[model samples]
Structure formats: structure tokens, C-alpha cells
Target: MSTTYFISDHHFGHKNIIDFENRPFSDVDEMTSNMIAKWNAVVRKEDKIFHLGDFSFLNKERTQEIVSQLNGYKILILGNHDRGRPRTWWLEAGFDEVSEYPLIYMNFFFLSHEPMYMNKQMPYLNVHGHIHGQKYEGRHYYNVSVEQLDYTPVSFEQIRDSVVVDEEQA
Candidate 1:
């Protein structure tokens, strides 16, 4: 079976992230290329990838180009940065789904951008990007790595197992 992968906050073509996140890339092109390479390394043609949001920077053309290079059946969870663009752009890019809220699977919740306040009462574990490294404290969240996420989508089973282990220890 094909693997499912999840990733977010690539911010391709955005040089500001270097200063903001202390990323090592010197320019936007370098950052975009590196992110593509990292994604291609683990992604296969048959994989399914969910991009949480902030997929690109500045222009839609650049975003389209970068998204085209990645291999997968892509699904987009729209982020705040994706505003102003028509839905057609994402639809044409091969994204199976596009929404502002989280997508739920099994007992987990998938969000492209971070929630202002995670719903701690929910049984679902939240997987999201945007904050980079802020801990979730009592709630469950996954901070996916861009360098390693590639095209492979994270599995619900893997997330459940990790949460189970963490909860057991707590």
C-alpha cells in the first residue's frame, strides 16, 4: 500500500523565514530547492501527502511550480497565508481537498495551521505546524519536520501509538 505523509510550513520562496526561524538557507531559491529535495528523497509517486499550509511565498506561480515538482496525491489544508487566492489554484494543483479547519482521521485531528487554543477535551490528538517548537502542554500535537517529511504522509496508527506511549508514561 502507498504511504500517507503530512508536512507544513515549507514557506518556499520566502527569504524572511531564514531570519525568522534561523534557517540556514541564504536565499529563497536555495530554501525552495532544499525543501523540494528533502521531500523528493522520501516521497514516491504513489504516496499521499497532506500539506498543512504556508506552502509557498509571495506568488501563486512560484507555489504552483514548487507543488508540481513534488510527487504525490496532494491534499491541502489551507492556512492563513493562502488567503486572496482563488480556490481554482489549489484545485488545479491536484490537491484532493482544501479546507480551513482540521481534518479528522481515526482518533486524530489534522490541522494545517496551529489552533489558537487546542481543544483539550477532545479525544483526538492534533497534528499541526506553524509554531515551529512551542509545546502543547496538556494537549497532543505533532511538529513535523520539513527536512524529513518529504512526500510521505504520517499514519494515524503511528500517531496513535506515540500518543499511547506518552500517555502511559504520564
Candidate 2:
């Protein structure tokens, strides 16, 4: 069966990210290579990956180069840093689609680049990134930031298992 995955804040080729996010990498090259390797290890070309955003800080050409090396059909939910780029730019860079704002997936989940307020009263679960290493707590919130997910794509199965379904919804 084909699988789906979610991840965000890759910031590929951004040297400052190492210092800004306290990422465990010696340099930008190492971080980028390691992430690509880890991503390819779990994501097959036929699989789908929902990248919550901040995908890359490099120029279009370099970004495309990096994205081309990865496996999976990528979908991007534009983040804070991704705002300046055009939708077509991301599509050309290997993303299957680019969403400018939050997306509703499978009628049960809200996908966003930044974590949004969510409670049991809400109808859908919120899955997001952009917080980096911040701790997220709540029944309706699921963070797929690279920092939280060990710098790899997280399977939808794993996320589904963690979702807290309300009696009314279930």
C-alpha cells in the first residue's frame, strides 16, 4: 500500500539554521545531506509527503537541485519563509502542489505551516510545523517539525495513532 508522510522546516542549505535552531550538524552541507538521506530512507518515490513549510532557503536552482534528490511526491503548505516565492516556483522545484494557507486533508485534519489554536471543540485536528524545537501539548495539536520528528518524514500512520478522537467525531 502507498503511504503518506508529513514534515517541515527543512531549511535546506541554510547555514544559519544550524546556529538559529541549534540543529545537530557540523555545517549546512552535512545537514542537507543527512536530511536527504534520512528522508529517502523512509519515503519511497510513490509515497506522498506533506511538507508543512520552510522547505528551503536556497535560490530556486539550488532548491530544485535538493528537492530533486529526495524521494516522494511532495506537497507544500507555504510557511513564513516560503511566502516570497511563487506557487509555480515550488511546483517547478518538484513539489506536487503548493498551498498558500492551511489545508483540510481527509476531512479530519487541518494542515498548516504554523501551529494554530485547536481544542476538542474544533472539528478537525491541527497538524503543523514552524515552531522548531518548541514543545507542543494538546489533544488536537500534532507537530511534524523536523526538530520534533528527528529530522525525518513522519508517517501518516504514526500521526493517526496519536490523534485524539472525540466521542462525537468517532
Candidate 3:
């Protein structure tokens, strides 16, 4: 089976990223290109990528240009920043699905953005983006990277192992 990856909160074209988070790139164009490169480096053409949200800072046209360069079947989980774009815009941008809640595969829970609280009772591993790899406690969460917002996608097995390691150390 092909591997599936999850990433989110690219915020491409957002000039404020530099001041807000001290992103390395001087401009959005540089950030966008670098993100695309980082993603293609790890993802195969046949792999599926699930982007949680905040794909762009400008509009759909700019977003589409960046999206076109990336490989894989893409999906979007709409976030606060993605609000107001037409539904057709996302459909045309080659997203297989756009949703607000969790997308599941083989009992793993995937979302573009992180939820306030994860449900431990569910036989699900939550994958999300929003926080930028800061301090947070959860069963499973993937923090966004400025270099490549939605570039790397990890498996449930990988996440489980990481969580187990964290628990053991605790």
C-alpha cells in the first residue's frame, strides 16, 4: 500500500510570518517554493497528502499555483483562514475532499487543524496542524513547519511509537 502523509498551516504568501514567527524566508514566493521542494523530496507521486488548513495568505489563484507544483493526491481540511473561499475553488484545485472535522483511514484520525480536545475513547490517532511544534499535550499531533507546511506525512504506526516513547520517558 502507498504511504499517506499529513501536514498543515503553511500560510503561504503571508508576509507577517517573518515578524510573527521569524520565518527564514524574506518573502512569500521564497517560502512557497521551498515548501514545495521539501514536500516533493519526501512524498512519492502516488502518495496521498492531507493538508489541514491555512494553505495560502492571498487568494485561491496564488494557492493554486503553489499547489500545482506539489506531488500527490491532495485533500484539504478547511481552517479558520480558509474561510470565504468558494467551494468550487477548492474542488478545482485538485483536492479529493474538503472537510471541517476528522478524516479517518484504518482507524487513524486526520484533520487539517487540531481539535481542542482529543477523544481517547475512540480507536483513533489524531493528526493535525495549527500549533507550530510548540508545547502541547495530546495523544497525537503534528505541528506545522515553516519550511514546508504540509510536506511530511507520518503513519499511525510512527505516531504510536513516538507517543509510547514519550510516555515511557515520562
* TM-score for each of the candidates: 0.84, 0.93, 0.82
When summed lDDT is taken over every stretch of 10 residues in candidate 1, the lowest stretch is: 145-154
Candidates in order: C-alpha RMSD to true structure = 2.7, 2.5, 2.8
The segments of candidate 2 whose C-alpha lies over 4 angstroms from its true place after superposition are: 164-170
Q: Write the per-residue lDDT of candidate 1 for residues 1-170, one digit (tens) a residue.
A: 78777788787777787788777788877877777887777778898777887776656666667778888878787777765566677776556677766777543565546644566676666677776545556646776535334423455456667788888988
Q: Give the TM-score of candidate 3.
A: 0.82
lDDT of each: 0.69, 0.89, 0.68
Location of the lowest summed lDDT over 10 successive residues in candidate 2 = 161-170
- Top-scoring candidate (lDDT): 2
Question: CA lDDT of 2 in candidate 1?
Answer: 83
Which candidate wins on TM-score?
Answer: 2
Clashing pairs in 2: none
Per-residue CA lDDT of model 2 for 39-122, tens digit only, reads 999999999999999999999899999999989888999999999989999999888889998998888989999988876588
Candidate 1: global Cα-lDDT?
0.69
Model 3: worst 10 consecutive residues (lDDT sum)? 142-151
